[model samples]
Target: MSQSAPYALPFHHHGKSKVRVGRVWREGNVHHMVEWNVNTMIDSDMEHAFIKGENTGMTATDTQKNTVYVVAQRMSQRCTVEQFAIALAQHFVRTYPLVSKAKIYVEQKPWARVQQGGLPHDHGYALQGTEVRTVYVTYDKAGKLDVTAGIKELSVLKTTQSGYEGFLRDQYTLLPEVNDRIMASTVTSTWKYTSQPPCYDAAFNAARGALLEGFLGPAKGGIYSPSVQFTLYDMAKILLDRVPQAESVFLNMPNLHFLPCAPVGSTFKNDVYVATSEPHGNIEAVVTRRTAAPHVSKL
Candidate 1:
């Protein structure tokens, strides 16, 4: 039933995408919830499905979608998104002999417990802003596994103690140098772990805190940001110093501009500015220990 062709199938993977699920755990009156958008890809030896039009060994995409819900349901204990992703990935490789490897990507929406009269409500939750926690897990039949966790769309800003100056200028350069200006960015950070930490949530908190602290510095006098590039490096370095389990950290921070502006009758001052999102500077870097292997981001 097979026909030979000049082309060869060297790499093939198939699965489902955007399988959304919400899981909640309850302890007496207290409750916790996680809403994840999951995507799964399975690499398998199913060349026959392509070359010979065979469907016998192929796993349906619907089945893959159902597996995500099934795996989430089977998780009896509360677990981090990384743990859930790893479990779902391992399930495909172990359950299907044809599957050589499985990769899972999960994005968790931020939902903070609502406060009622200075106390957190037991079951009430409010949707936090655009920020989301993300994880990518890969598992192979040979036991090789990789996990990368990240934070996305985290918007931050500072009113002062930032500047850009003394850059190579050419005829095309029209921007002027300033000693003090507003710095803002929507940060996307990812860290790869050398080994699973005892508590993923704690590790995440440490990394996030480090990023914020590095950017804003102390309350008395904030740190001076020479440029976005300098701030990106500082944030990554701080994250590595705080997260021992993380072998490396990758940060993508776009320098969103807040242009100083004033009405025709009023003079321009630092207090008045116009916020802008597009036409921004893109800066990214990866910081890792010298001894650690070169870190690759799969997210």
Candidate 2:
């Protein structure tokens, strides 16, 4: 009888530790800064490293760390996270013959331009809120490129134009329906562009603008969301409608509750609320247009 296959399929990927890099650029006192934590993976036919402990195909993680700094300095043109992502992916895929594909994920820390004396301050900046921008890029030997951009920890609240009702209220459901109530969510969204946009900066800005507009625009003139489920769909639809370059969008918005508590005796005001962060409702979905192909890759 034929011998059984030696183990299952071999492990196909290796290389690179997490590399964190910070870059600050100054052009005639106008300062721009970005802090990024990057992780890279190289996929190749390197089962030898796993099966026989032959590590010849491995690229040192230390070298990967050094490469981040070097690439950041060599960048002469204005560098956005998306642009830097492409640069990183291309460098790894082209430099290493053994690397059949490269995957790079970059997280950008938020820093806002400081405003002083009513005008934007030159050479001054402050760390903004925890809102972070993330980018992911994949490059393959066949020249296929996939890029995804996202926002995280973006807090938004609207006192009007949002409501919730018409839910299946069983005995366990204690929440009451409200026509007008405080709606708040920490918005986390990601969009995969149709290939790379002509202008990465423009596409990013437009997509972000669509999100804000969908959330904050007038109910009469814009989207009147009856619930977070409705609002999430509208947000994705607006982005896809407004930005032609984006092929698909994903959104995860957790419902932050501001439950109404009854006023105490005769002095406690009913307007005051206790904001609870944990044990909130998590809603997420992906919106995409009908594609000609049966399957589409995700980021």
Candidate 3:
């Protein structure tokens, strides 16, 4: 390695408009098709991780969009959002030479024109534990393709049913204690891909299942349970294990607290549930990969 190039690789930009159809509903008692459109524009920072003069082999826009079209065409019959993304990205690097890798990012806007009618021909609502999906793709000259997807903004809760205790105490630990308190949050979680082939629907189901089970599992009622930290780790680990594509999981939970009510008629204020958003605790832990190695393969 006598010398690396002194210049930088310029950006490679590509845009695509993709549409998908589904048997949205039996409108007027007859089966009809509904369409979802995803339009995306991608710009790769080609020089960011590269040696300057090596940029001659980088990919171009035509090739990138061709990959997008092929991916979406293949996914016209898919059943899960995550699955669609993974497949699209995988085909890109597997096809092009200049593209030893490519990044696939999509922006899906509502296409059911009926929103102007309050409710359209076929309509749906976003619900709790339901979220928008995103993915990052990576590939290397060694012929590795990684597809990582996640559902963000999924909501979860425990009704005085989840709690933690037995943490070692210290002199500065004047924290109030409650045997049973509410646990609720807008949860954000992510999982990286392993070597497994992408099964968007299967991985989606497993991640959701693991999130729910880990938070609500009977480990407390089971044996050798430690603390809330343990529960979080368990939830993350379970997700990685059950979803073969998942290599590791990272979780961030902000312990949502509701303020205690002040009783007007009675002289008691300790037990009522008056609510206020904080000024609260933020808990974060990485459930795997203690050492910082390349996460390139997992996207």
Candidate 4:
């Protein structure tokens, strides 16, 4: 008979980091700026921390935050969110030998230059809407990369050319079907880039335009939609058609409700309605080419 001795398993694993960096590059008093909330995660194959209580190969989260700002400083001209995230992820894989993978996400808040005297101000700026621009990047030591860009909390509404019908009816079906109604949603969408584009900023702009166009364009609105599922498909399809570099597109639209209301005591009828944000319908779907494949294996 043989007895096996107890052995330690590797355990130093994940590192979570955040960076809030305000970048400004001035070109003769005309300044371009972006505020970013960057998050990075490092996944390693160190299991010794759990079994042996060792913390030697762990990378500090503070170090990751510093790396983000340092990389941004060097990239004043090419300071797109996607570019910064790629640089950050590459840094982790190259700098830390023990780290096997890095996932980086960057969110760029909307800020437009303030207008004064019928002109845009050079230094002054104002916070605009809730629409947020975001990027996610992943890098592996094995020479793999994945990049995704997205928009969040983009409130959209089309008064007409939207409806809900042709649904399964049952005892629980108290809601009535309508041929026309208000369509409102807080859109959250993400699209994975097949390959890194020449200019991430340009790609983002073009993709966003396609999404909005498909949602409310005259040509898109000309066709009738029976449900949000159809609209979601159209939105995603348009994005893929417009952005050739994109491999896939995803959309999550929560159907905000607008119940028709009429004055109780008066015989007057108004076109107004009560809008409800919660307890509403939800529709989500993803569109991609049948032959399209991920650049990197899932981590």
C-alpha TM-scores of all predictions: 0.96, 0.90, 0.62, 0.90
RMSD of each: 1.6, 2.9, 6.9, 3.4
lDDT of candidate model 1 versus the reference = 0.90
lDDT of 2 by residue, 253-285 (tens): 999988765657654244766778889999988
Sequence-dependent TM-score of model 1: 0.96
Residue-wise lDDT of candidate 1 within 114-138, one digit each (tens)?
9999999999999998888999899
Candidate 3's TM-score: 0.62
The CA lDDT of each predicted structure is 0.90, 0.79, 0.56, 0.82
Number of clashing pairs per prediction, in order: 0, 0, 2, 8
Maximum-lDDT candidate: 1
Best by TM-score: 1
Kindly list the per-residue Cα lDDT of model 4 for residues 214-276, writing each as its tens digit. Answer: 777675545556678888888888888888899888888899988887768654243778989
Better of 2 and 3 by TM-score: 2
State candidate 4's TM-score.
0.90
Residue 137 local lDDT, model 2 = 87
In candidate 2, stretches whose alpha carbon ends up further than 4 angstroms from where it belongs are: 1-6, 15-18, 219-223, 266-270, 292-299
Q: State which candidate, 2 or 4, has the greater lDDT.
A: 4
Selected candidate, larger lDDT, 1 vs 4: 1
lDDT for position 290 in model 1: 79
By lDDT rank, best first, the candidates go 1, 4, 2, 3
